[model samples]
Target chain A: MSPTPTTATPSDVTPARTGGGRTGGLRLTALHTRAQLLETVRVPIAVIGTVVFPTLTMLFFVVPQPFADDPAQATAATAQISLFAVMSVCLFTYGVGVAEDRALPWDSYLRTLPVGAGPRLAGRLLNGLAFALVSLVPLVVVAWLLTAAALPADRLVLTAGALAVAALPMLGLGLWIGYGMSTKAALAVAQVLLLPLAFGGGLFLPPQMFPGWLDAVSTWLPTRAGRDLVVSATTGADLPGTTWPVLAAWALLTAVLAVRAYRRDEGRRFR
Target chain B: MSAPLVRLAGATRRYGDVTALDGVTLDVPAGQLLGLLGPNGAGKSTLLQLVSGLRRPTSGVVELFGRPPWEPAARAGLGMTPQETGLPPTLRVREVVDVVAGHFPDPVPTAEVLERFGLGDLARRQTGGLSGGQKRRLAVALAFVGRPRLALLDEPTTGLDVDARHDLWDAVRAYHRDGGTVVLTSHYLEEVEALAERVVVVDRGRVLVDGSLEEVRSAVPARRVRVRAAALPDLGADRALVDGDRHELWTSDADALVRRLVGSGAPFADLEVASASLEEAFLAVTAAADDRSGSRSATGVPGTSTPTTSTPEVAR
Candidate 1:
């Protein structure tokens, strides 16, 4: 015969206390982020596919160009590529990742827990952020080592802030796509949206090169708004007056859609 | 009745035309190892889903710790293992345990939890690498990591070997001994017999019997009756089938069944009867109930056809 102890005793478990909400939520978020990151990183393609292309594009196209020696052009190019890196990482991570998680029964189990979706959402955001930062490293390093890009430490700091702000819409859009679509659909949408956003935003080619119609239409896109704000910050160029409002509007729209999609996604599936 | 830890007052859930849970009212006090015993599609999963807040009842009240089960706060003391849940394939078992344990205020050490569930050796393996039985055990173990007041397991030892099932039963028993309440659902009468002090048999979206294990056993009969008769009348056996002049019946009261058989003047012979081991009786009881209800009650769903009054199907 053996005497074994259970983790909880009846007397101690009388709705006495829930995990301290503020601290416990934060801790749960951290753990979720850690778990998501571990799972994602183990599949190298998930991280590598997002990080490699931006750095490769910079090395092959921008760094070899004559504009490689122009500080303004070089700095602007660096910022654009950096934005692409953030966009890709955020979109694929959330769009593909969230859809993948949604397809899992584990997700249903997690949703059933007393902890709401807050921690999981926060954790996923953090996971996307980590990869986004990682994807930026190679492109930024190429810009610094091979190009005539020059900026003060503060300017670099400003680029980071602009990049973070620029990442907001992509994050929301990624989340929206992730929660709203199945994995195959999300992967296709994330891929389909990537190049158009990059080209229209003048990330690969400057807006001055755009046709009259595209230049007019391009400015309305979130990617264009992000590029304008980031390019202005990096090159000391004048930011269009409409940039902030446009980006903010898209951010608001997509964030709301993402949240709503997530809340309803499980209900619709289980129903 | 110290205000039962879980209270479902006439909880009913309907999916389209299928009434998955039909007016089920039950109270579970703390520390009770209550088994929801039923056949497939007997609404066991739906009942657990209602209590776990995965799905709300279409009608009636479902409460955990006095609050509606749908509220996230009300789930604070509850843990659940759905019948077939996935483990994130790439993470090592230890990491998964630690991450889930992080959700609790006071968590069991990951290593200890692993050891208790015989998963210590598997701590470093990716969960995707685990065999089905191991994955099942790990899933069951995670429920205890949070030290929850209530654990809802929908067929926890489903894929395990008999040895594995026994090991898991001990772990569950230990948890119950320490005052953790368990509400497990299984189609297996044997499984229910092994772990539950209280048992509730559900069929066709209704609770057919609910009582302490001994009380249920004494009330339900598991006797098998075999007799050759030229003709047979309605003896009211829980289950009856005749094959080419040979009669087979499982009766709760074999003595009365015999008297009824002879008094009917059917000219029967070759009498034989046997009793004990509860599955036959349990199946008979549910089977008889199934017959009383319309055969369509087997699956209230609008489509799909399964044989009605199927004891074998129910046992499956």
Candidate 2:
């Protein structure tokens, strides 16, 4: 027979006195974030893909060119790639990850639990930020080794702060796509949208080389606005007058759409 | 006395044009092992979802521990295994158990849970690499990790082998012995027979019968008659289910039918009569309920009648 002492009866496993208080909720959120990070890290290919794609693009396209020897041009290229890294994390983590989770039965089980959505949503946001940060490491290393990209110590910190703020619209857009479509559809859409946004925002080539019509439109895009902000911080370039308003507008719109998509999905599936 | 662990009063859930659960009322007392038996689209999953607060009803009320089931506090002592669950593929079995167990205040240890479910060896393996049967076992085991007072299992052993099913049955019985309330659904009649103390038969979004297993069996008025004859005998039975040369009949009045059979002096060599099994009782209950609904629809009777009280029914 088992010799474990019976110190507590089944009834003693009653509801906790704290209920769903802030501390309990936060603790659960932390655990969820930790688990999600572990799952992502276990799949090394997923981590490598996000980091490698942008780093390779910088090596082949930016570092071998005459612009590699110019501090201002090299810094702009580095900033552009940094934005690319953040965008990739947002799209893959939010768009593909959310769609996949929705298709899972574990999602339904979690929805039924007493804990509110706060923990799970917060956990996902944290996971997205971690990947975004890791995604930048490769691009930074390549820039330092092969290109003349240089930033004052304070400007480097500023570039990071700007990068975080600039990633908001992309994260919102990812959430919108994730909640609005199935896994297969979300994956396709994320891929299809990635190239157009990257090219249109002058991420691969300098905005100075864009056609007149493209220059007019690219100035309004969230990606271009984000790039301009990052480039200005890192390269000491003058910030464009339209950059702040354009990025702010896109952030607001995407945030609204993301919230709407989430509510619509919840109403359709769980109500 | 305390309120029942789960209470649904006139709950109705509709999806656009489809009515998943129609004005249903039910009560599940503490420490009762209730089995839900029904074919597909019979509102079994919907009922469980409402009780677990995964889906809200369109009307009426669903309560857990005298509070709305949707309330976090009300679900603190509840555990559920849905019909289908896909565990996070990359996480190990042990990690999944630990993450879920962390949601509860006083959880059963992860190691003990894994051992009890025969998953001790697979604890370090990623869930995605596990076989279907192993995954199913893990899903069910997760329900007990929280040491919940009540567990709602929707088709818990649906995809398990016979041996696995029996092992799972023992685990369920052990949980019940420890004073846990359970409401489980299954399409397998044998599964219900083996474990259920109380059975509820649902059809077309309605509970056709609810009572002890014996009570449900007695509710059917038909008796099974088996006889051997050279050819088919005109025993004047209402319906016949035949196996080879033997004829099985369902008749309301078996004694009168048998008297006629003997008087006719037909070349019947062997005769046998026995009470109907639970399978037949289940079929009869569902059939009668279908007939009632069919006639009601034919008569153009609106389905918006007053909600019925939660009374155990011999027949719908």
Candidate 3:
């Protein structure tokens, strides 16, 4: 039998490629990203990790605590919410993302395609960033509109801006944990890391409410810096000048370690 | 003649202290269907991975059309269906093909690929829902979507039934007919015997035999000959596994001692010959090579050959 011929649909056929460029590589990266999106939508467990758990926490915070009579309630509340956002974006997203990556043969298969390492890395970063941003919306709005008061508009903008900048380092650091640790270890660490970082970073309470030493340490924590940036954003409180620098350093260090760890892990897993 | 599509020149890949592929070399030219047959840990998958550029060789080089194997341009003319199922389960059959097709500069239409593989109805079905044989066929279809110059297939027929296996064999034959080179690795001796014109037998990270199947068969001196005789005549020194009454005796060798049987006036009648099966020859060749390497332990690791020969494990 003669083989059946197939006609090209207009949408299916793009302009014929005449040049030898990195276009195929780019397309592979795009397909990977598309796959990531489809998986996020199709897998309910993924939805919970990315959206539901964080949203529930947002709702929890927006509800006023029973002990509103406490003298330092406002400062404590702001600190608590900041901690929640940071952990949600950094540890939760990154940790779960890593576990998800481990479950699939994405890294191995992608490495084989026309996709260069750079594009694959870029696609992942974009996905993580997108997920982090989506995670912020519910919590950010709930914390702002639902709460009686928040950092003033100008401070809120600055603090949000600062938090965004701070998030870059946390993202990189989270990648280090995700890439370096096995899936089981990552989950355990994420669980252990989540509670302390949240409580210590003062997402549920203000760091100032703690003793001087505790407060001093919290200042160095990424969550602490994120909280301070948020507090400064809303209340116009003066954050330490070193806050940005510290976050920047953390980001740089983590990025380097993360790249090394990911490359090493990929090399071993593929072999 | 066109240049060889894929070449492995002294290819070696090491995993820490262990060598996965040890100075292995082969050429897969156009219109050639080459099968890499070996027991488990024989470096068949490693060779396919090297050809696909999914992994690089530790020392020697793997080239496609004179370029390094990993180059996108080099891989453009190559198709690979890995030993493990690489297709995403949740994606529909069409979607899986489309995803792979997107990687190529010029990909065949998804519908055409689906129809060619008899997967037109399954196009809308998720890959996870397809049966194993269906999945394997889809994988083959996806590999052929770009009309690749060469194909690297690892255990391509792991779960197919007899009919499906024969259908896939036809597909492979058709692929070779289209001037494509195929490097297939399978545990199934019959699959390799039927599909491959050339066989490359590997054991313990080394190539034991690389030539036409007939030549590999001839390497081991074993062929079954059936003859009718009223009385048995064993004149020569060759060992014989004979059965049946004096009216007939079956010998594994016909050329050497069977002549003596007729010379002795034995009632040698109704003579028939059975060629030594490729499977038996493969095992014998592998056994001899292992013994030469002193790998009697059958752990399938090179340079660690033991003194007491162990049976070679079948490739999974």
Candidate 4:
């Protein structure tokens, strides 16, 4: 028996047409970002690793620090905790995920499509931000109950600002790791980087607890600056003005490196 | 012709020490189904990537729809189902198709694309759980969702069963019927023989043959017949012969020799006839080139190392 050809009425099938310039780029970027987010957030490993891990570490250490006296120290500790969450989610979560994805052929496949490097990077940034947001839930709840940490109106805005700025460099760091390192090496390197960046940034302990030499070095690090900014914003405390510039510099430099690594001849290994 | 849907002018790609595609030039006319045939390292995949705009050529240029293939307009007009099993395993079959469709400027409805590919029932099932053949089918369905002007499929039927392969072939026929051009590379000669209007054969970094099926076959030497006869015949006694066998008959012309056997009343029981297939012709061409290459290397002649075999011309 011959198969019958199906004819379509105009209503059954939409006519294909060119999307306008802005609409096309935006829609493509949205699709790419959504896919990136879903791919990351849907995994149980990411949820446990990003959201739960940082909260668990904070509860173990911060629950013991008394909020009764020296409220300034209590506030400083809260800022440090928030920075820890962002670091784990943005750098650790995003890095490992993108590394595995790079190994699996996702970049090659997306590059073949109409998706550009900019939109692809944007989608990943948005996904990292979303994951970063979700990771804050436990930290916020735990900090409010245990410590004298309260988010004031302006403080909340500052926290938002810190997250936005901090995401830029972490996103760049994650992409660089994804494109620059081999899969096995990336996992090991991410673990190594995650621990030092988190612990040394005063996530486990305050920066003041460090020796003079270490504290000086920590301030120069992106993690230390990020934690300082978050703590200062969340609490009505003043941090050094140098903190903002340092974080910004890290963001800009890492972003350039990430883009360079992505387009590098050595990065085209999936084929 | 208005313009070829895909055109390569001296396109070349190389890895540090190895060349993938070397100065390949070809035009895939609009609405023509062109097949790319080659072995694993024959550079067919590289050629497909160049045409699909996945990578820029190391030298020369590749154009699609009369523009650089990587441009947004050109990309929107092209669709590719890559050789690697690259789809995210966590995504549902339906979501995968829908997501790929969303990348296009104006894509076909997701429901129609799914139903057409018989993937409606598997819509909610995750990609990881799908069988290999099912995943391949999903990849193909995703490529068609955009109604792209040019579809580049690399080893599209690798894991398909017979029925699935046939189903895919039907979909391809339907796609071509809609006036879309297709450039497909596959190790499956039968698939190429069935689907492609024109075939391009690549060996190493160069094109060994490019023409219609008949033209390729004509370029190949005539099929040498081998028959296990009770008694063997003498050379020139059978027209033309390189060697003979006591119980084997050799001839380029099978039918003429078969008639002669009946006329001369030769006793024969166990008889077998072997004809050269596209695969055989491909191997013969490549092997001969290798022989010429070795000979040139031995004599230390740099320019004459690569043998150039002209394909038999076909009158249009």
Best candidate according to TM-score: 2
* Candidate 4 wrong stretches, greater than 4 Å: A1-23, A67-70, A265-267, B221-277, B292-316
- Tens-digit lDDT track of model 3 for B99-191: 777777667889988887789999889887888889889877766776666677777788889887887788888877756678888777678
In model 4, the clashing pairs are A79-A231
Per-residue lDDT of candidate 1, residues A81-160 (tens digit):
88988998878888888888888878878766767777888898888888888888888888999999877687878878
Interface RMSD of 4: 7.0
TM-score per prediction, in order, is 0.84, 0.85, 0.79, 0.84
Better of 1 and 2 by lDDT: 1
Q: If the candidates were sorted by their lDDT against the true structure, best first, what order would they fall in?
A: 1, 2, 4, 3
DockQ of 1: 0.37
Candidates sorted by TM-score, descending order?
A: 2, 4, 1, 3
Off-target runs (Cα >4 Å) in candidate 3 are: A1-26, A66-86, A89-93, A99-103, A149-160, A267-271, B221-281, B288-316
lDDT of 1 at B130: 91
DockQ of each: 0.37, 0.38, 0.20, 0.29
lDDT of 3 by residue, A20-139 (tens): 353544665677677666655566676556655655665565446653333235533644564476556577557656655655654455445544555556666666667766766666
Superposed on the true chain A, the predicted chain A of model 3 yields a TM-score of: 0.76
Can you write out model 2's per-residue Cα lDDT over A113-151, one digit (the tens) per residue?
Answer: 657677888999999988887878888888998889887
- Per-candidate Cα lDDT values, in order, are 0.79, 0.78, 0.64, 0.69
